[model samples]
Structures are given as structure tokens and as C-alpha cells.
Target: MNRLTVRAAIHVAAIFAIYLSVAMLIPAAVDLFYDNDDWQAFAFSAVLMGGLALAVALATQGRPPPVSTRFGFLLVNMLWMTLAVAGAVPFMISSLDLSLTDAVFESVSGITTTGSTVISGLDQAPPGILMWRSLLSFMGGLGVIALGLFLLPFLNIGGVSYFKIESSDIEDRPFERFQIFTLSLIGIYSTLVFTCALCYAMAGMNGFDAVNHAMSTVATGGFSTHDSSFGYYADNMAILWTGIVFMLIGGLPFSIMILFVLRGHVDALRDPQIRVYGGYCLVFSLVIAIYLTVANGTPFLQAVTHSAFNLISIITTSGFASDDYSLWGPFAVVCFFVATFLGGCSGSTTGGIKAYRFLILFELLANGLRRLIYPNTVTPVRYGDRTIGDDMQRAVILFIAAFLVLWAITAMLLGATGLDFITALSGALTSLTNVGPGLGPIIGPAGNFSSLPNAAKWICTAAMLLGRLEILAVLVIFTPAFWVR
Candidate 1:
């Protein structure tokens, strides 16, 4: 709240804006190659944002004083808002002729990796726009990982303080320097994207579509080149499998990934969170596959493939649809909705309540039941080998409670905007979970969010931001107590 904190936040946002402005050129070049007039929009946005960002960055340049926790909250919120505004500029200026609300909604969805779309007919849209969307996901995915690794733990949101304690232990640090860890993350992220693109291309996607999808898949961002999503290649088992593989990878903990891949720490793969995540994916996929095979008469092999891909897609919060599972019947709808809340591992690109939180909740429930039968017995809840402290337990419980309350509130707000029960409920759930595409004929997998009222779009935009920031980080800033000190 102090001037120094505000100035520091501005300085960081300006530098980020400068980098984002430069990123605009890649899409500009793509549009130019395709002879699309939208290249002008990208060029204009890049110059305008770049020039202002440069000036701001220069004006704020100096060694900043040490800041407080308020500075972290302020910087994060301001930087994401700046990115949304900067990302929306091209949409407003381009041939798409989007209104401010729609542009911001789309930008929020993309940057939050929510994958919700207000713009349809993507098959014929400008190449630059498509590239820009994919780029937003790729960047947003990386940004969120960095946020999870450092900021959220420092803020002690949810149960992530445990993560910080684990990482900071004398023998447990991944790298002594921040720079080395960052470089490793970037290397691993880029390598996955590149390998995914290669697999997609080999599986028969054209280079552009392959690259776009690879970025989305690796990020679990789910911005597809076609409106049908992965259904565009529904018949291509290879491409579908490639997506399934990478989406799962995208959902695993990146810190564990770094140790397992770079440092050859085989035991990292045995992480309890990773095991719970895998278990949920496997169990849910099988249940869905069985339902499809029995109720829908889907062939067994085909059932397994589609069920695994689509379920993994939802669980990872990737939002890709290989088929209209909404039409698969009421049971499938219920299953998918449940999967929406079961996000991937913490520190991964995916979003939801997260697998570890559920693990902790279940463990706590079991322990509580045990206490009733044996009152004198003591049980220390454990995640991996570490005992869960009372503070961590309370944080996790509070986060889940807050998440559900917000979801219900968001659903009511959407319903007030004239959406039906299914649409409103799923819209709230999807936005809060960063799992795109609600249920029903409106915003279902077969449909888009383009028909929603402007107010609804804005509401969903707020929900996406809150969900992406793990609810508490954004909410804490609004409390009177946060500013009093």
C-alpha cells in the first residue's frame, strides 16, 4: 500500500509488459506470412505497448527497497491485469472487431488457461490471432508455474507453506540459485512443447496446427486451432494419444519433474501427490470407459482411448473435447463434472481443488473416524513422509470451503443473468476450476461462451482470475485487515 511497494509493482509490470510486447511480433510475422490483414493489429499493439512499457520501465528503474507481503499480492494482481489489458488490445484493434468485454473475457480465459472461448469459427480466423492465443497459454502456463514455485508459497495460501518448508530444508533445495531453477524450468517446458509438436506433426497434423496444439497440450491450456477441439482429429488415434500423454505430463508437479528428469532422482516420481493424481486419473478413466462401453455400446478399444483422453483433459483442466460427451447421457455428464474439481498435482499447470488437497481431506476424515473408535490413539497425518501441521491442515480446509462458497455465489450470479440451472452451475464450476466449457446446449463442449451476456462474461473473468490465483491470494487483498498495518 505504500509508495515504494506501488512503485516496485509498477516496475515489474512494466518490464513484463515489455517482454509481452516483443512476444506480439511472433504472431505478427505469422499473420504476414499468411497474408492476413490482422498483422497490422499485432504490429500496432506491439509498438504501442512496447513504447509505453519502455518509458514506464525506464522511469521506475532503480534498486527498490525491501517490500512486504502486501507487495507480492499487489504486484501479482496488477501484473495479471496489465497482461489481460495488453492481450486484449489486439483483439479490439483487429478485424475481429470484438467489444471490450468479450476481448477481456477471451484474454482472461486464455491467460488463465481456462480455455473458454467467446470467439468461434476459429478454422477461418486469422493465423496471428490463433498463434497469439496459443502464445498466451504457453506464457500463462509458465507464469503460473513460477508463481506456484515462489509467490504462492511465500504468501502461504492453501497448504502451500508445506511446499516451501519442504523445498527450503537444508538437504532438499533443488538449486541454490533462483536463476538456475528458472533456467531448468524453461528448458524443461520448452523441450516438452517441442517434443509434443513433433509428435503431433508426425501424427498427421499440419505444422501450424501441430505447433499450436502442442503449446496448448503441454500447457494444458486447450486452445485448439479448430472449434471442434481435438475432435477435428477424432479419427487420428495417434494425435489423440499424443495429447493424452502430454496433458498428463503437463499436470504433474514440475519440481518433481525437474528432479526426475534433470537430476536423475528416480524417487521423485514416487511423490504421494503424483501417486494420488495418477490414481484419480486411472480410476476415473476406467469408470467412464466402462460406462461408455456398456451404456453407449462404444467399442472397448475406442472406449478406452476416448475415455482416457477426454477424462485426462478435464482432470488436467485442459478443456479439450474429442467428442460431445454431454450427449453421452446424464451419467457421463455427472462424471465429467466431478472430474472438473479433481485438478492435477500442485505446482502443475492445471487448476482446481488439486489432487493433494483431496488426499489430505480424505486422510483427515479417516483419522477423525478412527478417533471415535479409539479415543486415546494419536495419528499424525502425513503427505509423503512429512507430518502435516495443524496450520497446514486448517489452510487446506479453509481453501476448500472458500472455493465451494465462491462457486455457489458465482453460479447464482450467472443464473441472475438469465442462464438456466445447468448452464449457470457448470459455468461457475468451469470458470472456478479453470476447466473450460460448461454443460448444456449453451456453453457445453459443442458450444461456446459467445452467447453469454456481457455481465456474465465479466463475472466469469473474475472467477477465472480468482481460481487461477488459488482464490485466497486475490481475496486476501480486499480484506480491511490486510491494509491496516
Candidate 2:
């Protein structure tokens, strides 16, 4: 990549930072309404972040240059890291007086949509802070969708190219096509958020709670205004069911949602990824609900509701908890832990080894078995209507391998820092999957990440970045070959 490419990337990233700073104003308005002194914190953060962004933009400004693929990878990663740190400014400056590590951890969690938090007293925290957390998740969700739909496909990351829309250059303009696609995504995303908010309101949440929960739900980010999370609304079935519906909507493929919106067809909903994701949720939910009812003697309806809600929450990587499923039984614990790795569909905001890769992996295994049974016959693996190329299969396999390796390493590192086995393992899995809750008391659904050491928090932060970037996007930058090019 040329220097101009790097410069242009920095310039565009700075522009993104400026746009991000604008979100601080929403929190500032909340502070003003609540008469909280935290308004100055947001105000100062906005100016500082915006000013730095402006400085960078001006210094790097000139004739635009083509952004090389290498630079695109670098830019995407850098923008996330930089914006994350910028997002932390308010947390550090506000009355909460969060330590630098805590601030960065909270900010990273929000921007990565990991939904983990360091703050403990959300019930009494300033409305501005609560709004900021939800806003970060909402914006982070948008960023992930854009990355999935546009950049990942272009970069061929993790076999995401499977979803790329074919264009006919002879008949259509590529730039206009992209523009229309992007606008459609934004429109659909906004509508979902609005509709979810209205549903939450009708479900008995006040305006603020409805809006905040809607943003978190649609993003699958799980930043509830209360420390108890969705548990705070446990008595309200409407709210819980509303969350379940919207969280599922958020977890499904955004491209499919776009198709559903424009073409007025359910064809996209029948995609292998969506079908697998839905089936997985249903099966897991039923298993857990049955275990809760039969084993624990819990009321059948309550058991099902709680089981389904928490199962969907984790599987979708939404992270909202109606109740701590950890107390259900050892069976429920195992189920929830396993669900952490089975995130929602690709092209959605949910994280972890996405359902698409799992489908690909299963197809590969089935084809391999068939090949062994009939050496003379050739079999081609197919996902949906398209044959899965060897290259894409390799990419998917490599991604899963890298993800597991990284998860193990992260767990070991956390363990070395003196965390218990359960805490370390669950913490590693949750961070890597962008799932919010771990299994143990310290960081479980009933708890937050506040007690972790600074080192562990930073480790989790890195894991969040690595996981959200799909491993290869961030790790490729560290390789000698990437630099040599």
C-alpha cells in the first residue's frame, strides 16, 4: 500500500471519529434533562474527541487515493481500536470516576457489542451514562453490519464472500448499486430499532427504558439500564417476549432482512444459515426448558419462558438475562456454555463462530464421510444453492481453528492471572464470542466484570477486538507476509 492509501485511511477514520463524537450529545441532553452534572463530562469528551479527529483529518487531508485491500484491513481494525478509546473518555471523566482500565474495558465492551460491563450500580447511575452504553452498542451494531455486508465480503474474510451480490457491469453501475444496498441496510436497521422500541413501550417500559432497551435489543448488545438487566422486567411477560422477538430479529442475516424488505419475499429467510440458527435456538431452548421443568420441578411455563429467553440471549449473543440460568442445574450450565460458541447468523451483529461456519463445517464432515464410503465417486459440498469452493472451505476451517486456538490461549492467560478454571474458561469464551456473561459468580449472568484485575480486563478487551474482527482480519496484519506486501 502507498503512503497516500494509509493517509486516506487515517483521514476516513478521523471522519468516523468525528461522527462518533456526535453521539455524545445524546447523553449530554440526557444529563441536562436529569439535571445531572455529568453533562460536562460528555461535553468535554465530545470536544476533545472531535478536535482530535479534526486535527487528524486536516493533517491527512489531500487528494484522495485508492485504499488498497491491506489498507482496508488496517483501517478497519484501527478505526475500531481508536473509536473504542475515544468512547472511553466519558466513562473516565464522568462522576462514576471509573479507573482508566475500567473505563477502557466498559468502552470496548460496548463498542464491540460484547455487553460486558464494569459498572455495578446501573439502577442509580446517571441516565447519561446508561444512554451512552446503549448508544455505543447500537452504533457498534451498525458498524458490524456494514463491515459484514461490504468489507468482509470484499476481503474474503472467513468465507463471507458467499453472500456477495453479483453485479452486471454492462448493465448496472457498481457505485450506485453499493449505495443503494447500503441505504437499504440502514433503512431496514432503523425500522427494526423503531419498531422494537415501540413494542417495548407497549410492553410497559417507559419512554427512556423502551428506547434504551430497543437499541440494545436490535443491536443484540444487551446493555440494560438496570444492573439486574432484563431480570428487572421479569414480571412483565410482554417485555421479555418483546426482547426475545427483537433479539432474534437482530441475530438473523441483515442481507436477508434487506431482501425481505425490498423483494417482499421469504426466500432469504430460508437461507441455510438462518434455518440452522433458528433450529439451533429452538432445539436448545426446548432442551433447557425441559431440563428446568423435569429436573428442577420449576413451573413449566416459567421454566420455558426463562429457558427460552436466556438461551436465545446467549445463542444470539444478545446477553440479556431474564434470570440466571446457571442456578438451573449443571445441565443448563453446560448448555449455556456451549451456546456461547454458537452465535447468530453471519451478516448479523451477533458474534462467535457464526452459524454459517458451523453449517460449512458440518457439510465438510458429511462430504468427507461420503468420500470415504465411495472412493470412486466425487462429491461437491453445497451451501444453499452454491457449491462451496475448496478455498472458501479452507478459509472457514482456518477461521474455526484460529478461533479455538485463540480461545484456549486467552483462557490460559486469564488462568495464569489467578482466575479460577471456570472463571477463566467462561471469561475467555464470553470475550471471544462477544457474549456478555460468563458462568461463574464473578462474571456470570448475575454478576458483572467489575472485580477482574486490570490485566484481565485488558486481555478481555483484546479478545473482544480480535473476535469482532473475525481473527484473520486482525492477525493477518501481524504476519511477515502481510507487511512484505
> Per-residue lDDT tens digits of candidate 2, residues 355-463?
8898889999998898899988888988878688877888898899999999999999999889999999999999999999999899999999999988999999999
What TM-score against the true fold does each predicted structure earn?
A: 0.98, 0.97
* lDDT, model 1: 0.89
When summed lDDT is taken over every stretch of 10 residues in candidate 1, the lowest stretch is: 162-171
- Top candidate (TM-score): 1
Error of 1 at 314 (Å): 0.4
